[model samples]
Target: MRALVLDRPGSFRVAEVPDPVPEADQIVVQVECCGICGTDLHILAGEFPPTPYPITPGHEFAGIVAARGADVRPDLPVGARVAVDPSLYCGYCRRCRAGRDNLCENWAAIGDTVNGAFAEFVAVPAVNAYRLPDQFDGQLGAMVEPLACAVHGIRRLGLLGPVSAEPTVVIGAGTMGLLMLQLLLHAGAGPVAVVDRVRYRLEVARKLGAAQAVTDASALGDVRFAVAVDATGVPEAVETAIGLLDRGGRMLVFGVTPAEAAIRVSPFRVYNDEITITGSMAILRSFGEAVDLLSGGAVDPRPLLSEPLPLEGYGDAVDRIRAGQGIKWHIRPI
Candidate 1:
């Protein structure tokens, strides 16, 4: 099997490696499509501390089941198409016990902490594999992972209650931001306002149902939203989103900001306005829901899909993502 081996930060090569053999409770998946994300870039630059060297980094992916361990569920037979949830949680951790597994004390993810699906074949826990509907291809299946993250973010925003029809503001019209915008609309959110520095992305946002798409929040002067979501992971964008919230509003920090980044927030305003601030880490129990949403066409992944490249072109894919050339770039590893 051939895999992208990151021998260390700033170095990687497409080399032949032994095919992964499933553990007692794991299954081997023949990789089909794997989406490149910001986290991959972090791992490449040695910015993500959890990542270990000499590993394959691709968490958002889907493929066909090639083999199964003896202890794996009998229901998941070989040849089944599945989308994997890469979260690797310690079931006994305090946070895991409390149903907040995303924040497990021993937090780890398949791609981040261990070898992942950026290869011809990868082994994953059988439990993390969810069967995709017959209608979903590898591209759509690969989208489930990121969509799951966005789903969890919306849940953190308290979407269970009645969502006010007031305009919701989504900062950053990138793939995640656009996905969040669509989910909000599907959940009955009133006219959404999307902000992005890229004019083309704003246009795509409008096509995705954003009532208004602007380069900056100031373009919609004095406009306040019941919910504001920051998907840019930039401190300045987060602050701007918070400032756009209305009284008694909620803010969801769904982006991965720098560990050293800090934003200025008025404590007095937070107290007086009854502002609620929360953050969503990664996928929780939302992977299945994301699959359903995608299958049902509630959220379209086509608009976000960019041209796929072969596994050997991984470096080019990274460059494309870093340059912000497209909504989502995928690697066809098969």
Candidate 2:
């Protein structure tokens, strides 16, 4: 099997490696499509502390079951197509006991903490795999992971809270931001305003049902929103989105900001306006819901899909993502 081996930080190579053999409760998946995300870039740059060297980095992926361990469930036989939840939580952690596994004390994830699906074959826990419809190709299946994160983020935003038709603002038009935008609409959260520096992304956001799309939040000019989401992961953007919230407004910080990043906010205003600020980490129990949404066409994947490259072109894919050239780029390992 050939895999992208990150020899160390800032160095990697596509090299032949031994095929993964599943444990008694695991399954081996023949890689099909794996999406490149910002986290992968962080791992490559040595910015993500949890990642160990000489590993493969690709968490958002889907593929066909190539082999199963002796104890694997009969329902997940070979040839079954599936999307994997990369989260690796310590079941005994305090947070896990409290039903907040995303914040488990020993937080880890496939691709980030172990060899992941950026290869021809990867082994994963059978319980982490969610079956995909036979008609769904690996490309569409790969979207389930990211969509699951969006679902969890929305849940954190109080999706079932008192319905207010007031508009919501989503800062950033990247894959995650767009996913959040669509979910907000699907949940009837009212007209959504999308903000991105790129004009083309804003156009795509509009095509995907954004009531307002602009290069900057200031363009909306004095019109505050009842809800504001920061998906850019930039301190300035997060600060600006927080400022755009109307009195009594709520904010969800869904993006992964740098550890050293800091934002400025008016403490007095937060107290007087009774503002609410919250954050959602990675996927929780939302994977199944995301699969349902995608399968039912509630969230369209076509607009976000971009041309995929072969596994050998991983470096080019990274460059494309860094350049913000497309919505989502994937690696076709098979």
Candidate 3:
């Protein structure tokens, strides 16, 4: 099988590697599409500590089942199309036991900690692969992972239970931000405003149903929101999102910021106004809901996708992502 192998930070190649064979209770998937994420760039730069070198780097993906281990259930037979949840947790850890598996003490993921779907074939645990509906194509199936993350973020915002029309401000109109915007609208969150420096992304946000889309938060001056979400992974942007919150506002840090990154929030304001600030990690039990949302036509991420690249185009795709050329990029290894 041909895969984009990252031998170390700052270096990678499309190399020929032996095909993956499913271990016990695992299934081998013929990868159809794999989306590059910010975490992928971090892994490439040696910034994400959990990543190991000489590994295949891709997690957001979907594919057809090519083989299954002997113990796998009949429901997950070969040829089934599916989207995989890359999260790998030590089930016995305290965090996992507490139902916070995303924060597992021995946390790992498919692409982050093991060889992943940036190849013609990859082996994953059968339990992590959620079967997709017949209507789901490769690109849309690949989107389920990010949408799952957004779903978890929404759950963290406490908006899942009821139609809490909290005036919401989503910072950064990138793929994740746009997904957040759509979910906010779907959850009946009201008058959702989107902020991004890129006017192009703001346009996309508007088309996707943002009540207000601006290149900068200053454009919405004096308009405080009840919910503030930072999806840019930029500390400055996080602070800007914080500034847009109303009294008693809830702020969700949905972005992946650096470990050393820090933000300034008024402690006095948090105390006086009873502000709630929460951080969302990766996918939790949200993957199934995301799959349902996508398969059922409730969320459309197709607008965020451009033409996918072949396995060999992985480097160029990375450059495009770094250059901010597109909303999302995918790799079709098949």
Candidate 4:
């Protein structure tokens, strides 16, 4: 099998590697499509501490079961179409026991800590595979992972309705930002606004139900939001989003910002206004719900997807994402 193997932080190659064989509880999946995520960028830059060297970094993916281990479930047979949950949680971890597995102490993931789907084939635990409907093709199935993250973010955000609809601003119009916007709208968050420097992305956000899509947060004028979401993972953007919240507003940091980055906040404002600020990590127990939403047509990501690049185009995909040239870039390894 061929894969994009990163020998170190600043380098990678499309080279031949041994095909992954299933473990006793795992299955070998023929990867169809794997979306490049911000985490991937972090791993590529050595900024993500959990990642190890000489690894394949891609977790947002879906594929067909090509082979299965002997103990695999009957329902998850070979040749089945599936979208995998890359989360590797320790069942006995304290956090897992408390139903907060996303914060598990021994947390690891397929692409983050192990070899992942930036290849022709990857082995994943059978239990992590969710059968996709026949209607979900490669790209749509690949969308389940990111949507799952967004779903988990919303869950972390808690109850959103406040008697009536109010403005919910989503900062950044990238893939995650746009997905967050859709979820906020479906949660009955009224007249959601979107902010991004990319005009095309704002246009897409408008098409996806953003009441107002602006190129900059300042362009939004003095308008304030009952809820504000930062999805760019840029510290400056996060600060700007925090500033957009109205009195008693809730802020959800949905983006993966720098671990060491700090932002200025008015302690008096938080105390006086009763403001609540929270941060959402990756997928928790939300993978199934994301698949359900996509299958039911409740969340549409087709507009955010662009033509996928081949395995060899991995570097180009990274550059495109860093340059903000596209929304979601997928690597079709096969």
Tens-place lDDT per residue, model 2, 99-144, is 9999999999999999998999999999999999876888899999
Residues 35-80 of candidate 4: C-alpha lDDT, one tens digit per residue: 9998898899998898989999899999999999999989998899
Off by over 4 Å in 3: none
Q: After the best TM-score superposition of candidate 1, give how far the Cα of residue 115 lies from its true spot, in angstroms.
A: 0.4
| Stretches of model 2 off by over 4 angstroms after superposition | 160-162
**1-334 in candidate 3: lDDT tens per residue?**
9999999999999999999999989999999999999999999999899888899989999999999999999999899999999999999999999999999999999999999999999999999999999999899999999999999999998886557676899999889999998888998997999989888898899899999999878999788899999999999998888878889999999999888999899999899988999999999999999998887777899889989999999999999998989999999998
lDDT (CA) per prediction: 0.92, 0.92, 0.93, 0.91
Q: Candidate 3: minimum summed lDDT over ten consecutive residues — where?
A: 158-167
Better of 2 and 4 by lDDT: 2
Residue-wise C-alpha lDDT for candidate 1, range 99-193, written one tens digit per residue: 99999999999889999989999999999999998988899999999999999999998783357587799999888999998899989897899
TM-score for each of the candidates? 0.98, 0.98, 0.99, 0.97
- The model with the greatest lDDT is 3
Report the Cα lDDT for residue 226, model 2: 91
Cα lDDT over the full model 1: 0.92
lDDT score for residue 50 of model 1: 88
